[model samples]
Target: MKGRTFKHAMAAHCESGTLTALLNHAGLKISEPMVFGISGGIFFGYFESKKFPFPTFVVRSRPGQIRTALARRIGVKFAERRFRNPADGEKELDRLLSLQIPAACQTDFFYMNYLPGHVRVHINVHFVVVVEKRGEAYIISDCYSPELASLNRDSLMKARFAGGSFAPKGFLFYPVSVPEAIDFRKAVWKGIRSASFYMVKLPMPFLGVKGIRMFAQKVVDWPRLARDTEHLSHEIMKINIFLEDQGTGGAGFRFMYATFLREASELLNDRDLLEMSKRIMEIGDRWREISLFAARIGKRRDLGPDRLRELSGLIHERADAEEIFFKELLAMSKKKK
Candidate 1:
């Protein structure tokens, strides 16, 4: 959501069916299925993925669900933006996923509906091949090259038709055989990486893709951010106290902001500091972004100037946070030089 990286966007493409067309349209001889997991969302090979909301389809696991895809389709939830938590930094990771599934219909999907258990381990990855009914057997690896960008239509149709995810590569747990689940994670992920900005922008902000945005908005969206920041400032102060609460051999690195700032100052460069500064401002941008949203809503009477000032204070506090990052970064950059 915050940054636009190809890895982050791969799920959207696979979920959306765009990748199928891209690969299949290329006239490759399609073969097998890829295992993209289900129920619990799955993240493929990349890290640093931000959360994405997709319309989820909840299906009833009835025995004959797959016979008719339309009979198997369930409810879809429209995802709203969710915030990012700072505590999530540098920790054990959770995967991010987005989807573009047919609301109802099927040869490949409507199968999840008939499950008795809530967490069905439908395929873990996806199996994809682009076989031209009788063509040169050009596989999807048989399709787009980095230099070629985009797929031709005839091949796309074939890939799309055969497209469906498989279980992880080299895993023996497949309930069904995909025959070949190779080379497609990258290809499918590549397809996801190509969607339009507007398509992912809303998801980005909500997903808290930009930690800086959350960091910034933590103080700015004071509609809630204000109260929460107030609580966080108190809690972080508490946690800071808690960090030092335990017994210490006093052998490990002492972690004071001052120490971090001091060491950081000696470690980075002007360019790095400038890049850091640029990034800090992006957080600051969230304030204006929200303000613009409010202004467009145009409820002058609904949002008083006092409320606006309070919001301004919230943003200013975020600026203060940015200022802290900047000052520490600048100090380090100077030291590094």
Candidate 2:
């Protein structure tokens, strides 16, 4: 029963048993891939800052008997998942010792929410660790669930101030009352609240539900849609054209349009949509062929715009019709669900 309020948390660092000073001490010995974070939501930063490139490893630390409660209800993705299993807890604990304090490490910070109860604080912290092989930065990313995101009725944009202040509930900590490491985490996540992961740095089209899971959902249903082959012909043709029309630099309006629609397609299930989807597939196939041809002709530079316009014409011509069709498809999908 350590104090549960932020005011009590102010003197948190005074506890030498906490992870903050431990991480600071660890930093004195620069080393390789490692992790040092609380269990309840403070992110670790090694390779890059949150706003830049690098990945965040979410850690859930515990030094208590009731740690059994965490065996399953809590889970995560990314290298952070390295800590997911029951067997690796001791190993992760050791690795934490070897980790160096991220260059940006701060003695102060803030965050949100909390998991109540117990002897040792049960909190989760997010960390930014770089993937390097033989000493070179490899990849960067963020771990978040859309389901978790959708729970936000607040529609909070990832803001500079978003995770900045120590949350009203104070920082998320690992395994209860056991000297909380909540201070540093609250300080850190707040620092990088508006930052995007490395994957986001690339000039990607950023289509909806930006994740492999979301992408997979669209991909999985594709096979089911394939059974309607004949109806797919024109549909595919239109789709290819639309994809190309997505615009000039392979960025902006058309890119967003095509990417967004591909995701939007997932929301519908109308006969017309199925019909249109079939055409979209056609165009997707044809575009590959056309792109190949353009490469051969050295006319690829013009290919993008030409294709975008040709494809856009279909949707443009049947704008209202397609909207109604897709809306019906959406309604249909809801009914099926």
Candidate 3:
């Protein structure tokens, strides 16, 4: 595989970052937040499964959907290929690299050597760009990493083919073509409308603003419902850390969405979105405070149900704010149309 001038820039999230790099390389010059928002990636989901030790909470859409959604909305053509055979997958990646094309691959963060030991869990939806293959390693641009890193061929294979739910299965994607021009205003309107619909109108209670409220109620009941209070506290602490400390660009991606709204406001010359952006930023700060409160309660020796209730109240407040904001956003979008 040959090398090309692929620039690596740090971003808040992996899928958006990889798509940003690919689009820029294809001459589209898009930003991470643009890719994220235009694809309607901001979302919430909470589900309980026997496979997971505790309830699962996610701040964004399921893996691989963002790329597909962005491509469909922006008139770009992308190709994704998955392999049951690792050797065949490597060969295809080599073929693309030989053409000097960078490909995004889904992988397990546990196998990425650049990440810290503590964070190397069995997360399989992590995205990285495999730009070129060196003699024994694959050059990658991982968004969370400070600098470019190289993964050994063996490790890369393991990461790509890691077993579990949402496994990559040696999948790779790259943009085949991008439109020379885009209707930024139209795209922004569509993006905002779709996001608002998902947040406010989704039927499932375990998604969007309703999911936030549901999770809060669960948190409030943890002390009484949990069979093991210590284990439950630890799980709650993990949720807090995941929400605030993970590379979610703060407030589990509310700040990222707020930035997109700010940009959209300037692009569309709408002051309403600007005001909503400020309000969302304030909400993000509140979320950060809640995380801090939850963390403090997690560390306490006694199970503090009252503090948990306080945290629940804060989440309920956030949910209320989000519901109003999205409803207004939907109205604004309808007016623009």
The TM-score ranking, best first, is: 3, 2, 1
Whole-model lDDT for model 1 versus the true structure?
0.25
Q: Name the lDDT of candidate 2.
A: 0.24
Of the candidates shown, which would achieve the greatest TM-score relative to the real structure?
3
TM-score of each: 0.19, 0.21, 0.95
> Where is model 1 more than 4 Å wrong at Cα?
1-8, 11-301
Taking the candidates one at a time, how many backbone clashes does each contain? 47, 60, 0
Model 3 TM-score, 2 decimals: 0.95
Report residue 203 deviation for candidate 3 (angstroms). 1.8
TM-score winner between candidates 1 and 3: 3
Per residue, candidate 3 scores C-alpha lDDT tens digits across 1-337 of 1254888888998999999988887778778888888888888887888867677688888788889888888899988999999999999999998889899999998999878887777889999999888898999999888889989999999999998999798999998888888888888888888888888899899899999888888876666556687886787777677777666888888899999889888877989889988988998888888777777777783457677777888989989988998889889888895
lDDT digits (tens) for residues 51-143 of candidate 1: 212111111111121111111111112211111332231011111211111111111221222222432223322222222222322122111
Give the Cα error of residue 287 in candidate 3, in Å: 1.0
In candidate 3, stretches whose alpha carbon ends up further than 4 angstroms from where it belongs are: 1-3, 223-230
Instruction: Write the residue-wise lDDT of candidate 2 on 1-337 in tens digits.
Output: 1121111111111111223222322222111111111121111111213542211111111222111222111221112222223235323422332342111111111111111122112122222111111212212111111111111111111110233322111111222222222233232122112111211222332221122122222322322444353433323333233224211112111222233234334433234434544543443344345434323323323323344344333323332332343344345434442
